[model samples]
Target: MNTRPPAARQIVIGVVLLVVVAMIAFLGSLASMPHTDGWYAVAAKVDWSPPNSVFGPAWSILYFLIAVAGWMIWRNGWRENQPNAAQKTLTIYTVQLALNAIWTPIFFAGYPLIGEPAWWIALVVIIALILCVIWLAVSAWKWSKPASLLMIPYVLWLVFASSLNAGVIALN
Candidate 1:
């Protein structure tokens, strides 16, 4: 039996989730924005790297999709009597969200502030982030198909980004 709260309540929660995710992205951007012109401009990047102009808009869209996916799972995954599935689903969601949250500072501030090791460290974190994303989609599939499907573009973007990071490492 579906144990979801009323639609109105659920909608309110979703809107809140959306705003929260946006805030997380905004905070991350604060760490990242300064570096794009300073460190990133000179950093060795893949020849095919999208112009710096592309990241902000791309991330804005991705963050929206991620928020929606999280909301969908929250709506569909719970049963009042058996909350285990929902708890696990949200736990995975949180794990991925946390990984996403930490990636920006590690990448943008790593080299300039922490020395050469930060690049490799950031690469590790991004790779873990990619894996967590894939895992979230798979786990979310049991609760919400749309949530699962929503992660595809994110996965693709991350793959492209990981390759770009790898290239940066290779060149520099």
Candidate 2:
């Protein structure tokens, strides 16, 4: 007899999750020192590279979407009592987040300093990152269609990032 739809709780949790995701993304950006010291300025970029100004806003939007998608999945799983699927989906999501976090430092800082092995390592990481997002998209589709729809931009961005990463590897 108490079906109020729980919007308040969901909103709170979603906002909290958004902050957490933003923090994680901020830390990743910090670790990369992406803008402060002109690290990216020296990197060899292909003609298709977007302006440096685009990355910050693009990533901010993507991360917000990512958090919302995760929150949607979390809310559904909590309501439906599907702990196993939730766990798997969250695990994939976490892995992708971790991969996204490390990519900037690895590609921009580590690879350039260490030479060939580092470059190869960055490529491997990017490939793994791509795989993780793909998994996230598929798992989200199975768990929540809206969540899956939410992930499309992130997936597309990652695909573009993979090409950029590959280009960096080839050029530098």
Candidate 3:
């Protein structure tokens, strides 16, 4: 009895999802570049504007983890069997991704950017925290405590990012 589905299919799904998520995150990073090097970057330039080298690569790694985490949940026989939580989780994942992608434009491209990037930063923090909860539950669904454990750093990183965003807004 093939209790589990195909590992190959799950791996493929993981890869594709990772790529898509990375692309979206990268695009959002690019969209924010003009401001990063200009207004916000210049104004916030001191000893701590965040290392440019760290941002994109860090986000890419996070996206990859996200894809793997999602695939793990899917492979737990939840996507089809535990339809409700699975659906909610996936929907939250998409919403968080969309929110992550949109924050750049709102803070960078919009005229009268308003309270600076603080608002977008706060929103990202909230969304990321929600995702952490979702991912934790998704991991728990499979009785994989280690898997749920993996998302802790990610949640902490988001908290750090919120602080950085606040710092930037405060400086600039």
Candidate 4:
């Protein structure tokens, strides 16, 4: 029989991990605040672009789901005697998180300053971000099926966000 700690301790660890992920996401959002409004206000957004107000709640829910999915994968991998799979899973998760954190600042700060070239850069970053999330989803599938399933919404959001990014580029 596995001799892991009590369920309560595992629960606490999962919650802590969730909080860490949430905080990272929250901090990234906070960092983008200074540049957000000005850029959005002036950007040539497409008709399908979501209202600015929609972003916060959408991101909040997505971040929460991301954290939970990551925690589930972590928990599943933690039980293994060898940690290779866990390490790979967590590395992919970390990469996606890093990509997520940087995207806002890149789009907000870099776009306006560079003019048309910025659109290409932004599109590249968005595509990279999408790929990273997809990689995370696949890695999570190996670690935990439910965790992989949980990432579907996040991937879908990234697709929609990519469309919005592309639309902005094309419109502008």
Candidate 4 per-residue lDDT over residues 112-163, each given as its tens digit = 5766676677678778888988888888887789989888999899989888
TM-score against native, each model: 0.93, 0.84, 0.73, 0.85
Model 4 TM: 0.85
Estimate every model's Cα lDDT from 0 to 1. Answer: 0.85, 0.76, 0.62, 0.78
Which candidate should be chosen as best, given TM-score against the real structure? Answer: 1
RMSD (Å) per prediction? 1.6, 3.0, 3.7, 2.5
Deviation in Å, model 4, residue 128 alpha carbon: 1.5
Per candidate, the number of residue pairs that clash is 0, 0, 0, 0
Question: How many residue pairs of model 3 clash at the backbone?
Answer: 0
Per-residue CA lDDT of model 1 for 5-121, tens digit only, reads 778868897999789889878888888888888978898888889998898899889999999999889888756566546678788889888888887888887778886677778
Ranking by lDDT: 1, 4, 2, 3
In angstroms, the error of model 1 at 17 is: 1.6
Clashing pairs in 1: none
Task: Supply the global lDDT for candidate 4.
Answer: 0.78
Better of 1 and 3 by lDDT: 1
